[model samples]
Target chain A: MTKSLKTVQLSHGGGGKEMDQLIKSVFFEAFNNPILCSEEDAAKLHLSGPVAFTTDSFTVAPLFFAGGNIGKLAIAGTVNDLAMMAAQPEYLSCSFIIEEGFAIDDLVTIVNSMAAELHQSGARIVCGDTKVVPKGCADGLFINTTGIGRIIYPDVSANNIVAGDAIIVSRDIGRHGATILMAREGLALESELTSDCATLWPIVEQLIAANIPIHAMRDATRGGLSAVLNEWAKASNIGIDVNESAIPVADEVKGLCELFGFEPFDLANEGTFIIALPQAIAQGAIEVMQRYGHCQQAAIIGHATSAHSGKVVLTTPWGSHRYLDLPQGELLPRIC
Target chain B: MTKSLKTVQLSHGGGGKEMDQLIKSVFFEAFNNPILCSEEDAAKLHLSGPVAFTTDSFTVAPLFFAGGNIGKLAIAGTVNDLAMMAAQPEYLSCSFIIEEGFAIDDLVTIVNSMAAELHQSGARIVCGDTKVVPKGCADGLFINTTGIGRIIYPDVSANNIVAGDAIIVSRDIGRHGATILMAREGLALESELTSDCATLWPIVEQLIAANIPIHAMRDATRGGLSAVLNEWAKASNIGIDVNESAIPVADEVKGLCELFGFEPFDLANEGTFIIALPQAIAQGAIEVMQRYGHCQQAAIIGHATSAHSGKVVLTTPWGSHRYLDLPQGELLPRIC
Candidate 1:
């Protein structure tokens, strides 16, 4: 095949010879596997017993950001959802909608990022679909990923949190939202401030393997830490008491939030996660988490309490308390 | 909740209270079910044995056509892939990328179409994600659906077609492609011509119930009949002899093809499917398929042969024959 065109055309998605060549040179080379190479309408798998199914769509602005591109985020986002359910990320279905005239080289770069991210979780993209629309019909590219995995640890539910359980933050919060804000504004920060976009299967697998009695776990994505806490409080019907000073927020994120007039707790974090477990095992869990580079700032930020059921209470360092409500308005669009 | 805004805002996908309200009022009510109501990061499914996984992204232009909208096409397209593999469509993940300022009422209508189409397959949309881009960032709306189903019948491979097997189409060809062309061109026809977009699970279920010996099955979506036949011939390494006159094409479709100087075999069909089976079972399959209202025109158009292996030969009514090649260039974009 000759490399005459630098950008994708309608013919690239027309289900013709050009489309076949695009799949072979791009998608097939990056996501090579026996099942995918079969090129069947559907991929066949021998899945048995309980499974975890999840999905996410990535349409972030400026397709490339400080820490990762949309393709990496697409893979990590869906894989993290499965890992939150104590499922080992196994297979994923990737679908892309690209605008006509999108640079083929840029697409290849994004796809390669996706392949690199999948390596961290040992997940495979078995089946996929691609569609190209007119140039003005879409901005650039949007990706949707749906994942299925075997449930390694069952009954990991948000409704399972109970009084006396400790809530732990996996890492510093709000990096993703802050990074995107800076990228959109064309800011050059003095310190390295990047989105913490990464696959969480490794850390989650460690927790499951350690036999920790995890009550609930979730990644703080769109609505950030605030939304996760509020949902957990409502679902578990328990009150959560937080120590404001303990939650880790990097100085760069705090600075960006101050400049943007936003709350760090309400901003997104791609790799940050919240875990609920028995108070006795909080230290052990933190130690295990800190072994990973991304989890260096892990700390216990809150605990489930019996008072004021179905609400999250935040205590300031100066001894004042207030409800950290679920985000009410648009914090930021396309943060994930 | 007040029905104040007629259009969707960026806040509706901001992972806040507005987004929650939108979900409850629109998607939740239409796709109400126990699994979807769990409100977890992922849906827990108890799947066992062999399973089929597939994905499709629907960027169909105009959003709505005579018989279906993008939502209906999204569900049917993925479900049909599983049904073609003899898999019982069960679970699906739906993701949407909506443009800001898109009408909320139109979104609801499209979503309702999706729910209605799911009834034909008994497949549930268990987990979903929604995102909103700024106005002009996307063209109204786009949807991606990924489906998983249990494989009731195994080894139905495209490469399994052998000599003496008959090729049967479930319904008339080219209706879907022509319908979109007419809609885009704003043409007025005397007779109604609508897309064949529909769920094929019901008809496929009946065929499975009757124990027809199916060797290969596929839907002629983007590249239509010519793509399927050419692919089948190459994959099976067998010659395919098609009686061009025996293939069914609706009057409206034939007229549109004539006007556009396009071949009917190169047109798309969303709901239509092709099956390969022993000559002895061809009539049995056709009888079961024609029982469906949309499948009244079901017929066998070709047979697998040993002569001219890896080629699809078309026999005309006037005693002429030629090779039917796979579609080339961009016949249509975003047809499904």
Candidate 2:
């Protein structure tokens, strides 16, 4: 009976003895905390005042990625959401849906990655649940993380961007998207091109500590920079004019986009983000961000305007302008 | 392109135009609320003092089940977690992982079911995310719900179960597990056997409102009544003596268990719960629970004792005593 339990079986998620053993030996040992070890139905917490709540289900393909794996993404993804809201991430709930026969070793590796990533934001996995499906019923594994944090900076909204606000890209665009594309397509790159899938809490915390009047902040995930700019334009009822030449894109990302007929602005990004603030303080924000290695390439890419409300206008290197619309069709699936 | 849009496509989860349309027309319309429509990265909440946080992932096979579908279970399961802690269910985050080519109509049905279930506990889905995987990579769909609620009563925990505490099962056991088994095995029982899938917040609210001194409360979900009792025994360092005949088991469940060599006490349940309270208030708690139609069969099936600490002793109909250990092996997979 013990021999057959080398890999996770249906019994491991059945809330029985096998499940108890797996949770204790794996999850409890990795994510040890007072609230979690209490074994209550729900984790008791002492959250007060304004809190930020968010959820994300990570289904990134090729669980082991170039820079990080799905477990790292799961923790950082949800933690970034709270950070984007200018909140200090505090608590998270991690749930897993595993397919039967998934290697126990792989599961352990993924869980350990999650525990390591949690330290990046000082967040705790306070509560969780697990479900397992039969073989072929699900891909190797999928993780869902829900996070809550205290909102230290309030009134930061997509609708809060004003006409004089400046747009800043945190780092080089499309590295994450291009990295995943390369990984999936088996492309061998000469340079050390990896995913920008790091936790943004450090940089975001720095910005708040530096006292930048941040109007809006968001990670350029999923629909990428173009989607974020367009949504901001529509939500804040302002026109956004971006300089095409100023937005930084890595050489490898540019090469992949050209080869795959994808736009750098249209692909997904896991770790990169966009920030909007009053133009007077934009340079200060850039200086604060540039102190970090990941944000060394941060630059002012655009500005909000009243000319073309509900739209984003891109000024090309040739001094001609065109609308940068929201991305329409599927570019890459399971990028996150 | 429109011709192929009858079912959910990969684009619906691509974080692009199609994904936006799907969210607006499907989820937004069904779960319409001010917080959700705000379109922020994280929903801003005003939770104060003590709060209860919990999460559950639902991957039930046969999305359309006997009494409820996966969506209903998703909301109820998470809400019940908070309710079990004597918390007032308030806000929830819903995330979905969908398989490509899953029926759009079925997805809508599940979403509607989720919206209906939210009304039972007055919990709003404040934030959500949707992801689509390629076909055959996953089953129909899986849902993860994380909830936060204000604690109305505190210190209700498994460790608080003291000697002289009466243990009561909210309703019949094994119905959900048996129903799923019958569905999977193609058993056409003569009796109308449906799962005991339901939202327990309404009944739980009544108990708390009546000021019952509850020591511990938990829903018998995965490992059923036996698991709950065993955990209570170990956590509180008290022996649990349950009268085997007093436990309510329907005729269909008993027949199925007898035929399949399964124990009714070890089967999964969705709506059923067990309460541990002082014997002085046990009758009052029962009266409050029995007010609901689903709890008509609620009975005091056990009592916490000092004898044989850290174990569960089950007295058979012939007065023979045996240790009812935590269940081992997989009795049912994806039962939730």
Candidate 3:
């Protein structure tokens, strides 16, 4: 019967026959697992040790994007939060607020992308809820994913950073923010830029296995490299000095930032992350990241300092230094 | 700076200064807890044993209702799902997707309601996220809450119902649905009706403490009593028989159901729940519910049977029997 309908109707989320059918045919089919298939009021899980819990809501416009879609971002974003805490991601709960008359084909594509992304972290979607609003009440769709994982490397924390700790970037930045701008501005045909929206669990897992002794690890998601560094500086009550030339940025992203008058440091990155560790082991960590984690562009961009506490200073290529403040106003809305 | 603006701006969700100020003043101030104040990517929790996890998204139109707002419903809905599994509501993660230009006063009121509701189950909002969409991209706001708790009574499940089990209703039904309908229709001044929106943990805790052998337990949410009963029958592969006269319904609910030509059994209940237990303990369960759960009208309305497997048969007051199939199409959208 669902095949007879081209789009999702209000009845599909009415908690009745049509709702059950849609969940079984779409969500259950894509995310088939014993825990979810049990169909209880809540999922029963066996958890122990220090558990890391986090949540994120994705309202990215144009659900479909160049490199990934909202579904992929929803999964990767929550899983990456766990990974940032040096946790082993295990379970996730997904809730969808869909608009009436959304295309069933697009829903399928999104669900399939979610299923594929889950494979990167070995996390299972255990329980979920669905609701549908009238057409004008919502955009296309919004997804909220909450995740739980066991903290394997328990010493990692933002406040743990200290003087002499080297700051490292996982990869090139600003691609995700620039890509979204391009998509929204109808400049998709002008360049081949794509969002760096990949799951970071594999890379994080390797670093943990290598005993990197990371002090802090965080994904540069919403406010990019500047946000993470500035937060760490304020949280740790220390100063951070960066060699601006060491920070990686793609040419297309740089060009777009220049054209739009946006800073690359303020742009967002879905997959890129920053790390803080002892300078003695920074080179070793970078080597492990490149050799085993496949983060070929990973580099030590900066280091913690005792001067100018609670501030982040950037050294330009011409040897001039300036404060890299936390982004103040709206950079780009719904970039995630 | 935020005091100057009466409404939320797109910059408040931009992951920068304005967003930080809003979060600190609104969410952090109300939900002040050590874990949440730690300012980490994920909250670290020590969860042991079999954990119950559930998620729900609240998109109830007319954000503020007679009895409760979306904030109260969001917390109670997810907490009830865990309580139905005989779990101790412990940690919760909340995510908000707000539309731009929404009133700031309304947002503060909603957050305060959430903080008050969390006290009902002693659950803490350990982590959360906020995202804002452009004006008209979404309704006023939507809240997603995901909860996790340790299962104390692990035997409760929808598939655990068996032959000769008594069916009980915790309280009168259809109040929440009727109340919302009345609100949407601008008839709030005509009657003194209120939504039965409440946290069910206190009642469920009393039942567990009394050692009532609960075979299956579930909240009567969307699709209402009929949906839960039908799902139980199919899951347990058993038949259920209900005496229509034994069910409880408020006068206002009955009046509204008749006016709208809708079955009371098909209307949703925010706080009411269904239980399956042995006939021998049925009277004791009702006593516990009434004395401790404050369920004045709790009653045993039906029993599970071996005949007519996988179906629910309701006996009318006039002595006629008919199948109470699941609600087929959309009854009311965005009721929760």
All candidates: DockQ:
0.88, 0.91, 0.91
DockQ, candidate no. 3: 0.91
lDDT of 2 by residue, A265-325 (tens): 9988888999999999999999999999999999999999999899999999999999999
lDDT of each: 0.92, 0.92, 0.93
Cα deviation at B310, candidate 3, in Å, is: 1.0
- Give the 10-residue window scoring lowest on summed lDDT in candidate 3 chain B: B287-296
Weakest 10 consecutive residues of candidate 3 chain A by summed lDDT: A287-296
* Top of the candidates by lDDT: 3
lDDT of 1 at B248: 93
Better of 2 and 3 by DockQ: 3
Between prediction 1 and prediction 3, the one with superior DockQ is 3
CAPRI-style docking class of model 1 based on DockQ: high
TM-scores for the candidates: 0.99, 0.98, 0.99
Model 2, range B1-336, lDDT digits (tens) per residue?
Answer: 322467899999988788888988889989999999897899999988999999999999878778888999999999999999999999999999999999888898999999999999899999999999999999989999999989998969999999999999999999989888888888845558998988899998888889898899999999999899999999999999999999999999999999999999999999999999999988889999899999999999999999999999999999999999999988899998
lDDT of 2: 0.92
